[model samples]
Target: MPTSSVVVVSKCSVYPDLKSTVKSLKLSVSDLPMLSCQYIQKGVLLPHPPLSSADLLSLLKLSLSKTLSHFPALAGRLHTDSAGHVHILCNDAGVDFFHAKAPHLSTEALLPPPDRDIPPPFRRFFQFDNTLSFAGHVKPLMAVQVTELGDGVFVGCTVNHAVVDGTSFWNFFNTYAEVAKGVKKISRSPNFCRDTVFNSPAVLVLPEGGPSATFSGDEPLRERILHFSREAIMKLKARANNPTRNPDFCAPEILGKQSNDSWGLNCKINGKITEENGLRKDPTAVISSFQSLSAQLWRSVTRARNLNAGKTTTFRMAVNCRHRLDPRLEPLYFGNAIQSIPTIATAGDLLSKDLSWSADLLHRNVVAHDDATVRRGVKDWESNPRLFPLGNFDGAMITMGSSPRFPMYDNDFGWGRPLAVRSGRANKFDGKISAFPGPEGNGSVDLEVVLAPETMAELENDLEIMQYVS
Candidate 1:
């Protein structure tokens, strides 16, 4: 297929005055020290429109303006203080708005098959220009691109990650949609009080962390989409629940005999095993679909890379701390409220361990991020601000974000729900994975995996992995 070219129809700044209800906002401690670099892009394709391009543009502009009036921080620009702390300058400088068109493309053409790679044209839907650089004094913290396609309209938003995480990003979009749809009251109003996160005056600095230098190579990274159906997920659950054929061989020494007893006991306690003839009953686990899928991908990706068995591999899982913290944050609390829970394991042990073992490990790590841990993390970062050390991907370090719980497919601007939602190419970093709810809304998962070309090739054909993909 020929790549559809996007032409910019209009470019302008959208300055929306903050409503009287909104006060001057600042970046919270959790938001500081983040790379003023990355932008989170979300692309939504709305089918055959009820409104013309001009009408849609006007509606979007008016709605976005009103929405920003409530979310005044988005209309602001990033500024650094004398102590190097980043803050939002709620000056209503404005967000960048681009009106674009892809005359030849259709929503259908852009929605690639499950086994195929997302086309480059699909990514062009997002407007990512000066919105990405926070070093400038007048840079936009958010950018919106509205593209007219043959069959539908594509709305792409790029929000600076330094100011917003996945939750805040979607919250902004959903609110925009609500306004466009003429909803009188938004379901979740944003809470912009930065003081709620921290009261310390010290400038927060992110811990220094990047891809491992030792494993850095020149190989190009590739992105692929992997689909796991509801049925497939069920089978994976079953497989994970089933007792290993060779427990003595597969179980690590750290688990020992107690590991076998625990596995059997869990199944028995959960009624996953029948009293008669020892036939396996319904699968159940303390771990959830997220843990199971994450564990499976981590193990399969490690094997696909053919990494040294003795090498250390880490899985950095992003955990939402909104509810995990004491005096839980409101559902619409804005800014970055995510903490990474890292689980480290030797490649040999990780590869050799049973799926349940890995899932249990992930589950435990996730459960560990309670109120105390989150508070401690905040204090630690406050005392010595530093970015999370994410050493080189080199196939050993993996980072997973986004969540099936996100309402990516639910943002409707009166033209019906989005036919497909996608992430921008900027997320295509090696060993990075994003999880989205399946198109069917049937409790399945669609994973967007980015890996080196060779590793991806191997992953595509791996029998063990393919067994659960369909």
Candidate 2:
């Protein structure tokens, strides 16, 4: 077992000029219920040539102050309006910062093959106090924990998802890194206009009447880290694109020449795909490494849960809407810009089919988010705001977070790039999954999955799933 002691607890506030005059900013519909309960947890390990605790503490505090100056919303607190809508009070209330020491843990122990129980060392680094709630009057929207270990330093951050999505989350860290490296100017600045999506001052209401159920607590969930190397991802991609691999598989429609009618179907400019025509193109031709692995994991998780073949299973994927919306959002828009796109299929159809079928379904559902669909989704939420369903470990549903595209490992705070990056144990909810870029810097993916113990045992031994992994 590994133990840690808190060395310091301080409040980090935004710089003066970044403060907002508007007392409160109403959260967009997408920022309502789900964001309120979710916290983005990240752990980065820096090894060797260690700085003294004092030096690290001073360095981080200074850099954070500079970073927060630009991202003023993070320094604010979450508050609720009379009508039950969640909003950010930009009163310059500080973020919770803690510096701790872990005497017995090593960076090596945190590596992959996460089949064992959740490690105590990593858990201690990313601890979240379930007792804290955003609905409270004075809750910090961001909390930082710096755990000094034997071989490396682990920096863990828990940012309120109600304020920012994965993109904005990383944007904060990357900017902090730049400031730490003595960069005079930041490449991107945040757009704090919450009304970009909702032009009016409409208070968003959740159908559930309140925030979503917090997944925090002592739930009987197991956390496992699975890494799919670059070669492994390529193999999975080839398998998904090959129709002969599965007897019932059909070649997904490929996006060839696009006619005006197909303008939004296959049109992609600068990595932004237009979905105006709906997702009618062949999915196999356009399947990405993320989509391929996601499909495999979805199937394996479903089978491991052993749901009834006749039952309907749902897969909720977090789609970054920065480039998917009309006119596209600013690159540095520092708020929740993710849409939880859900796909429903009968267990019989999903299980009876091949990897290609599952991949196609996943790909199509993702590409279906066009300019019109995104606006329509916002309007729908305005009329009937509801939390994204949090499915159970009984295997009928799954939710995904984070992304390989976010350049998480690149955050080098003057020391060096992280040896490994991880999510906190708080993400260990049954049927939850997180994807990160593999450590090799190649285009590989590291998938962290949380499942019930029995289901995980079954998934570990799954031959088909194991084939694409090491």
Candidate 3:
């Protein structure tokens, strides 16, 4: 509840467009009223030192109550009428607080102790024991726990996926630090209105003669989440980055190896066998792999399976479109400033696609993104007389560069920089992948993959193979 930490870094300059970016996000989703910030709250547990349990709880409740008053967004309440539409409750809901108790079991060597039970608060919120359901009511997105360690308290926090992305979440946490430190006054600000950006979508229609493209499906496919372990990830990253000890090895070298060594590609297809109905070379795709995966994906990729014979599968990469958009909107406009570019080949294709081919295709695609015509093409497609194809793609792999220079880590609230920070959930689509910087500031990144069970196993096997090679 009390924000206090040593300082690591600081940025006094405010991004001029910061407020506009937030305003744009609220506007873009005006149609989805249920997705408001009033319901978006973060849970953090902080350990107390030299304090009694009762005394600690009381102090926390008071601090949290005061902290909520300052956020304005959290202080406000929401209500759903009989119509099922959400309305802002004009009054304060007053932050709620309750004491957490550890379960008890008598020590007995003869019999195994009863299964360790989860605390009530954790159960109601995390439901860590249950399977995740996308359609179910989204529970509390995050919760922070304060545990009393020997010398100090540890603060743990969790957040929901729908309310904020990583950038916005940190922004909120920074604001919290500002509030707890008495640096800023909390006002009953009504900043969550959605009309600011989308308020004028009609004026931003696309231009005619949009770009040509094809779609795997008419709709943007649903996303999936996955998680991978730290050790296994490190091994894959090391191999991907520098497969050969030879100093000359670079992207080209790695790319070539990936294509030529893929399982199906390594095995040649007989020319005569191609004449058979099901013997044609597989048309699968292998896309770019990133440096790391988000925490939520650790489990999914760890359990993925390999692809079935002859089935086509491709990996995808999300390219940031911030700079590629209208130059007039440049200087770094935020809010979904990205689009998915897919590179696919079957599992065999991934192994067989020559690195030069993969690299060339990547180079071409990357260059195409730089041209202004791409935006024009997008506009043309939007305004076309009939539906336009976006692209044919199966899944995605997202790469995020570490911004240690960004104020994200230095967002000090009278406290020191965070030891760890990450997204609450992985991407929402199957074939989704994520990554972030690893410790030690090495060029390597942590990675995660979300694939079907069979595909996941295949990836693991491939990873083992890479380990053996290096």
TM-score each candidate: 0.86, 0.85, 0.47
Report residue 52 deviation for candidate 3 (angstroms). Answer: 5.7
lDDT of candidate 1 over 336-376, digit per residue (tens)? 88888889888999989888877777878887789999888
The residue ranges of model 3 lying beyond 4 angstroms of the native Cα positions read 1-26, 29-163, 177-304, 308-310, 316-343, 354-432, 439-444, 448-458, 464-470
True-structure RMSD for candidate 3: 14.5
Clashes of 3: 69
Per residue, candidate 3 scores C-alpha lDDT tens digits across 1-470 of 11122111211111111112221122122222113212222233222244675565444444455544433333333333354333333234332333333222111211122121112222122111221211112232233343333333333333322233334344555555555445546422323543222222222221242212222223333222122223333333333323443322233323233321121111122212211232324322212223122211221222233334344544344454444544433322222233445444444443444333443444356546653644544454334422211222433232222222123343333344443333322222335444433322222232323344455445445543333221
Candidate 2 colliding pairs, count: 2
Instruction: Indicate which candidate wins on TM-score.
Output: 1
Q: Considering every candidate listed, which one attains the maximal lDDT?
A: 1
How well does model 3 score by local distance difference test?
0.32
Per-residue error (Å), model 1, residue 452 = 0.9
Q: For each of the candidates, give the backbone clash count.
A: 12, 2, 69
Better of 1 and 2 by lDDT: 1
